[model samples]
Target: MSSSLRVSPFSHAEEIDFIQLVKITLQRKKLVAAITVSAGLIAVACAFLITPTYEVSSVLRPAAINELDALNRSEVYKLPPGEALTKVGASLESYETRLGFFRANPGFFKEFEAPGRTLEQSFEEFNRNSISLILPDPRKADSLSAYIKLEMTYPKGVDGVSILNGLVNYAIDTEREQIASDMRVIIKNRLTEIAGKLDAARANYEVDKEAKIASLSELDNLRRAQLQDERKALRAQLKTLRTDRVAQLDEAIGIAKSLGIRKPSTPSLLGDSERSPSNSVMRTEINNQQIPLYFMGVEALEAERNALMKRKSDDFTEGRIAQIAKELQLLEANREIEVLKSREKEDLFLAGVQPLRAEEARLRNLSIDMAGVKLVTIDRPAQEPLTPFKPKRLLVVVIGIILGFIVGCALAFIWAFIRNRQSFYRTLPISSSGAGATSLDGEPPRIS
Candidate 1:
């Protein structure tokens, strides 16, 4: 019922002239064919004349963070950073290679770096400045198959040479854009990671320094105890010497009294109080009962002092008396001095070690606080290919030929339709003997 309604305005009698259309298309087939073939050939020919380009790439892993113990932390205390410090340097170098390969040639780099730096420094600075990551384009893929196909594809354009130049420039520019960005991201992330590690090391150094300070204080206390013991021994030896000398002095006095020699009442006889010794003729006035008067105390100390200036003062009985007297005075003075020294030792014991300990503490803490994170670098380097890696001519030619054949088939099908052979109707003619059906109204079917 729907088919009988018929939607189109045009009558079946006014259908297209298939044979006329066939004649027209047949006449234009050569033109279309010529143009298609020429385009395919031009594309194939362009591949040969393009300037060849090469690429080289380098890969690397960034360093990892090191776990630190106290002892290991100490070694770097106040010490300059080691090779691990140069990771940034190494990373920068990688960036330069990646960016430089894409950015510009080596000659421009040399010229730019000629001032204010040695050849090496200039190179390092250049690498630092030029290093960057090139990101990949979403549309441009580098799958193994894609790469292989790209390598095999033919180039196409006007004049062949023009297309080849365009392809080479495009490839270089595309590489600069895509690879550089990806490498930059990798490099940036690696540098940030290294920085974080360094921060951790610095924190460790702080803790280590505090521990060292505590240890140093404990050592100072130990040393103070030992020094006090030594001072006590020196005092004991001095006391023993003083007692023995006093006993000998008493015996010397008894001998002089028994001999009936009276000592001078005044210190002049012994030259105490800085007085000169009396003349020998005056010796009779110094009797046995008075023998101890001149020699007992301060006078004896003076005599001792004078006698020490004479030769052999300690070798003889008389000289021994003077020596003992001098010895006694010195011992007394030393005892007093020792009293003061004990106080000073206590003061200085910690005084001497404390500052040094503090400094050590500070340095250790600095190391730990600095946290010994060594830098790690990751990189993608610029590459020079050993062979031209692009524009596969053979593959391009094959594809173009396949496309032409498909087009040829389509054209053949279209031409066949346009020809519209009448044999189709002749072979299967409609049976005109059947009765024509009437509409529901029972009159001839009204043409719509």
Candidate 2:
């Protein structure tokens, strides 16, 4: 039952007209051969007429970030080599650079362009056909160690080499300028920052100085008040001492008068006061001797008081002196802080700004002569290629022949099918009638 259900639809069909199809195909054999031969000839002519392309390449090794670190001795502002190369690659691959290339050397590139090609068209064509930047060892990509293969292609081997070299040089110069510009911009920004910091530092120093000055002024006020109080007390004591001295002198003179002492030969050198005794006079010599002795004691007391006054005049209040000394220390301390800030400013410039500036200046001053340092090393220079890299004549001809045969076969089959269609339709009625007569019931004939 499974076998009967699996019967093919063509089981009742007549045999295929293999001989007639072969004869019809043979009649078109010349056309098939002509198409195939023409295709082969065309392939050969194209292979010969097409301009051969050659690739001229150079390997470049960029400078390492570690080298910059060695020069700078710090990593505060170090730029990685990979990052730098990335910028260079971006510049090299940029559309603007390609346009610039064509614009700069119109005469050289005109040979590569069609007669009516605009600069934009020329640029696009050049980008597609002329230049390529290849990174060898993609898996081991390190900016410092990775090699850049700068390749160019042209019809002429010499032209390929020359153009490749020129492009590499141009890319190096442009990238160096770009890198230099980047460095200058960075340094300029840093300098601006430093300037702002310097201003802030100065402002802080000034504010602190003012506050300290104010503090010193308050201390000075306290010191002055203390000194004034001390001076006032000293003056009061001095006045009392003067009054006592005067009273003692007056008493001595009175005693001398009471005793009726003979006037000294000096005639009262202390300005004798000849006032009469307040009470009855004592005319005894013992009283006379006592008057002299009292005058001597008063004289000694006056001398001692004068000496004390002189000593007090020469001395200063210790508290006030101590406060002044402390003020000086405060001033000196502020001065030291300002000095330190100045030194720090200088250090920041040296450590942060100066190195980057120097690098910028060096890059800015760079000429084509120093391209080697700014750009990567040229490990392998472009050499004139000896042979063409594309359009292998034998391979192209083989492909053309294969396609031509396939097309020829398809055409032959189609023509053969068209010629056999009428014959096939005429036989179909007869076969259907025969099948109906041979069937027993109303069922269709069984497929063998």
In order of listing, the candidates' clash counts read 42, 0
Q: Which stretches in model 1 have alpha-carbon errors above 4 Å?
A: 1-36, 49-53, 57-320, 325-387, 421-448
Model 2 regions lying over 4 Å from their true place: 1-42, 62-84, 112-117, 129-145, 150-158, 201-236, 251-256, 259-374, 397-448
Writing each residue's lDDT as its tens digit, candidate 1 over 260-291 gives 33443443444432354434445434445554
Whole-model alpha-carbon lDDT for candidate 2:
0.59
lDDT of 2 by residue, 262-368 (tens): 34312343333455533354332322333353344434544544554555332243344455455545544445445544554443433334555565455445333
Clashing pairs in 2: none
Model 1's TM-score against the true structure? 0.27
lDDT of 2 at 380: 86
Candidate 2 TM-score, true structure as reference: 0.52
Candidate 1: what lDDT?
0.42
